[model samples]
Target: MTRRARGLSLLLLLALIGGLTALLWPAPPPIFQTRTMPLPGVLAARCDEFTPRVEEPAEGVFVAIGYDLANTIVLRTSAGNVVVDPGMDLARAALARDALLARSPGPVLAIIYTHSHIDHVGGARAWISDGPPPQIWATDAFTGHFIKQYEALRAAESRRGEHQFGRSVGPELLPCTALGPTPDLDHAGSTGARMPTHTFSGLQTLRFGDTEIELHEAHGETHDQLFVWIPARSVLLPGDNYYAAFPNLYTIRGTSPRPVRAWIDSLDRMRRLAPEHLIPSHTLPLRGRDTIAAALTDYRDAIAWVLAEVLRGANAGRDVDSLAASIGLPPQLADKPALTELYGQIDWSVRAIYGAELGWFDERPEQLYPQQDAAAREVAMMGGPPALLREVEAALARDEPRWALHLLAKLRAAGSPDPSPELNIRALQTLGEQTHNSNGRAYLLEAAIRLRRPVAPFAVAVDDELRAGLPIDLFFAAMGARLMPERAGAAHESISVHFRDTDDHYVVTVRRGVAEVVRGEPLPGTPTPLASITTDTDTWKRLALEQDSAAWALLGDHLDVDGSLLDLRRFLAYFRRGA
Candidate 1:
């Protein structure tokens, strides 16, 4: 028990602990390895559908398919040509326009937009002839719906859209987009877009030249979607409703809840029409009334059945995953070519429906608050990152790519890069190649590519024409979304924006943690703002998107600042480019 003896004993104990720690330490993750597999055969077959050709199913009706993600249909008549859903951008639309002109030549009297999706309407200008501009048509809800999407979520959707469409990946990874070839976004400028000059609700019939068409407001893929019905020819143009694939009840790219019930109703309504010639905005047209009817019937039933099963499962207290795994299309529907999961998978639909109806809570108390840190601690307790990496490899070998991905994700989150991104890339590629759903495959492959090479965040281009159409409110909303509370800190300030062109005024007040936007002039009793901005919509958009520097804009007189330049810069600093 002497002091010297005690010190020697402590040193011996410390050495013993060190030796045990060394003995129990985990091995490093396996050397990064992967086995490349051929892409699925079904996907290749699906790609063949987008072969870039124009087909005429009915007299005076020319459809330019495979030219873009969506088809451009030309309804030729004595009066003029009526263009429907004009492809994605100017370049593609111009090609389609020339093809239609070669076959059925005439000035485009009217350009009918089946929906407000950019793909459907971005090529508006290309369809117009060298005469007075055509009257653009769309559902009344189109503008509001489109604006809502751009409000605060534009940047997020832009990034997700890139993945969903395989923007960065090569053709070997993604032969074609699920709907068609990847959209020509590079040439997709606002110059081609034309807002609806004529908006309608419910149903409206137009009789021009020898064509009599009915525009029925059918809510399906989008709230503002409509179907163009040619009564004289018994031709029905269902926009994104009945493609030759399982309907995308849920798109991998994030979206607001698709109204499944409304979608079913829309299909049923189409069935009642009993059109002999059915031309979808994507894919080839179908002939024969019975064949078209049968396809429409099966498509609707599949959707209805999935929705019912999801609801039934939710009511029975089953979790979302269980419902997604169990619910699938009946064999009769699944066997049908039109109902194949080429574009949309049934399981994604099931989860989407379940989540849309009942929020994210899975009813499991443990899931209420995620235990990410706890999971990392547990991983450390269970032989650490090396053991988890081994499990990931085992899962990959066993054809459980999803499980492998899960393990790899946990390892990455635990701050262990030993396994390397190569393992994650392999798992993602495996999943991507195996899945029949083209969108899913594109997203997976793009994600894998991202792990290998990080790219700049995708941002939707805003041209002058597009900027003019966008409301000032959207800029404010995006500002709020990009506001960094930490950057604001204890700063409490207010800035008023006045759009000279639109003659609109708005006020933005930034507190410590939140940014509040108010339309119109500030209340009478409110304190004066720190800065007041006077600029047109385009200049503001440029500043907001980081396309133009605020200091440069101010110097160029694009922006007129009433307050101190330093204060203006500080106010602008609170909002980052993208989240």
Candidate 2:
């Protein structure tokens, strides 16, 4: 070989070795180490509200505080003991139960769920006794509201909740989850939602033992929410309606439009009750008729003012972003202890209210068809990737991490390979440290870690105990939501499913790009399904949730497939779960 050719080959070999070493080498640690920062004075002071204890708001009324994200209230009466809001999970409920039982050993005559929230009702089974089950009571809309959460929005909400509750971040980052104690991420709890046996609409009164209970439908955070009023005791248990923090007119975790107008109305109703003792499902209890009345009045006015401001701004043709920036409580309301922005902030509530009132259209044609990609390219070309990186660095130095994040996004979208994960991490950490809102703080810090490494989609496994309470229809409905339309391209097939345990039958049809689910048998003119399967509800949940494999279930006789197993596997592949 010629000497020149030999030298070219040697250079190529060196390049190949360098490439392999680069690929194999471990990445260096992040430039900035994330540490838990000290909480601001206001947030630090709020932590005291969540200290675990049991307090009596009135005679014979006991509230187990800080047991979970919610409180458990036990009302002792001559007839028996009444339990209000069992809390988030089995262990916490059991702990609260044991503590309450130690104080009042009377049999629990009734269990009242203020609303259908998991934190309020999941621990109902833990309150069960061998003697007889306590009658569960809730508003008539409870079941429908409960099903809506578990079915359509399940996966998305779970992901958002991880941030909202600071589940993905370290405990030190969140000393208190605003309404409750720092989320116990180390211990997974069992959900025990016992469906309410009795339901009411509008208004209903019940006499349990010697205690007279009035259930009034008060839509606020949830459509099915209700506040419990005991006439004799002059005590009111105002569920999630009146917590110490500003009412979550909009939760960052996401929800259907909360009834802000109705929320204000509900607060008005509480003020009218004139209860000497006011115990909430979250935070500490309030006593004294005058004090409780004043708190309720201020809370109501705060919500009403926010709603009015959003409606006023929206009607005046102002954009949503501008509306959010401009609206906040007046000093009289902002200074009130009951109207703090710990849990929910005014800006988020402003946007939510605006959207709910006027819809997503902002009257701008350019916004109608967002030219984000075109804009990103234009931004990238303005100064190129190097210039953008310098801007990000400068933004970080100026303590403007949010601006740094915006620049980083443009860099990433431009497809630039600027090794700036360290820059991104520092920006996110700075933002998390500076944020006063617990939800935003957690999300920013968690995003920093996720930028450095792959973060798994948060999921809660379907256990046998929890599965029994779930409606079989939810699993099938969720299957449609989990469908991967692209993967199901050009595929049109139907599978008939029968659950022996619940005696429920469903027809799941994957047509082109959508999964359509129909309950019971098919209509007379319906086309014949491609396959049929028989399984118990529990086994189906396990299979659908990917906790158990279809192949294993078929082989173990846990599932009976009438058609080819290969075909069944292909059908299942059309859907995906998690984030």
Candidate 3:
């Protein structure tokens, strides 16, 4: 065949193949397609006074309630009233309803929620006029999970809150930062959630006041998220995932670690519909599908970018601090208004990702082999409660309150059933005073108080005993972020901690407010002969952290494991915590 004929034939074949490809692998669905998400004109454009356009919302008036971090949509129709998201605050909900009535025509017929977060539920009271409120709509599991997070974070915050938001009661505490565009009555670390009273699942559409609203389940930021679409207005409310920021890959304020994958998919859902306008609660509204889609896509990409990079570091065995420092969004994402790093930054988010994906392991050889603090201390001659007390004094003289803290620790570990409890208390108080950061102050203060706070002996209070001696991992993880090279030891430990999972793991066998690792176990889980030298988490922490293993054995217990006394000798040769 001639060259021209051959080229024509190839072109025909290529055209057929292209047609097949288009059918087989169509372009992904646009985020705006979820519903004809409208522009922020009638409602958002005038969100300031931020109040309503009219004195009373009449039938056909759609009012948006400010739900703190979420938005609740309310519709006033001739058939009572219909509301979505009820909002996060009752007062906000009332204001929104009042504003809608001011502008529109009737009463609320029904109320709907996009998800189960407390911010979404805060405004239910606003819908309730006299007796029963509008039927509350939510995922079946929404209320349960909402309550669970509420309880967990509520308790964990009191102790762990400072690290999350860096707030405390004293002068040493850092002033609250402008974490977001607007300030909140409830601090970042604190909870202002109220559980939702209703629940639902799957697709649910309701017709009221001449308008119909469609609700679809979208699991993105939270498990029980509900994405609503109004076909009439072409509006899509993507909730938190499609927010005007990098989407908080990890909320620094500390909630359940979100599913990085789930978040991406949610954005994809929003992307498919290609909504014309996007109105999220936290930031100003967005117009044009191209802009909103770009924002949502970039938001997804930003979170994905951070997650992938942080995972790369985690895979490379990087510590939390290094991983945090390494995470940064790309230019495409960094400049997007919706992808701003307003609320939660990538650093802490990366660490939370690390915690979620890879717990406490860096997979390095040093980590595989942990130094036995109690055993090493026994090998060293750093005993004598009084000598440690003297060392504490010396450290204090040098203005190294941290070093002084260590010496006092040794004295406490020596378990001198003497009047020196007063000395330990004083050392802790002094260290607490010297701490500059909120995290450091709270942690050191808590640690010192735990040590000095009078309590029964170890045998009597096994839990307290075990607690007095914190594990190396936990200890480092706590003080890890607050590391001052001159004061604290290495953030990462190349030590192996082998402990019996059962026997009061949290307590370190305290006797008369003294930490005693009375319960011991073999290094290797062997059925071999009698070896009463079981190391506890605390003893291991001290031996690994403070170089006081030898002293620990004197005050505690010790015995050679699988390698016999010879292996202990290897540890003795490499041991360095003791000075």
What value does the lDDT take at residue 154 in candidate 3? 36
Better of 1 and 3 by lDDT: 1
Cα lDDT tens digits for candidate 2, 1-579 = 333432222221111000000000111232234455677667778787777788887988999998888999999988889999987767778899999889888898899999988788877888988988788899988988776655666666666666566555655566677788764543333356778889998988988677888999999989999999999999999999999888888888788899998998898988888999999998888889899988899888999999998888878888988988889998889788777787888999998988898899877777887776874676657677777888888998998999999888877776677586899988988888788777777677767766766645434444565566656666655666677788897888877878887788888777888777889887554447766777787776665555555555655666665664456557767777333
Assess candidate 3 and give its TM-score to the true structure: 0.51
Ranking by lDDT: 1, 2, 3
Give one digit per residue, the lDDT tens place, for model 3 in 1-579: 333432222221111000000000111111112212232232222223232232212224353533233445555545766666665444555666666655653565666666655456545656666755556677776755544432313334333432333222222222222111111223221222333445567778877766677777777777777776666665666666565445566653457777888777777877887777565544445667697777777777787788789777776767777767767877656666445444455776777788788876756666677664653364246655556667777776776776765666554455445446655555655654454322343344444444533211110111232234222333322211122233212222111224544343221221222222222442332233311224554544333333343343433343123323332232222222210
Collision count for each candidate, in order: 0, 0, 76
TM-score of every candidate? 0.88, 0.87, 0.51
lDDT of 2: 0.75
What lDDT tens digits, residue by residue, belong to model 1 across residues 1-579?
333432222221111000000000111121223425666787778788888788999988899988888999999888988999987677888998888889987678898999988788877777766779888889999988766656567655666766777666566666676678866645643336767889999999997787799999999999999999999899999998889888899987789989999999999999998999999998889999999988898888999999998888888888888888888777777678777888988899988888889988877787887886976787798699888888888888999999998888777677776547778888998898787688898788778877766555433455565556665565565556667789887877887878898898888777786777889977554457876768787776666555665555655667665665456557767766433
RMSD score of candidate 2 (Å): 10.7
Q: After superposition, how far is residue 372 of candidate 1 from its true place, in Å?
A: 4.7
Candidate 2 off by > 4 Å: 1-36, 413-418, 457-465, 499-504, 521-526, 535-539, 542-559, 564-566, 577-579
Worst 10 residues of 2 by lDDT: 16-25
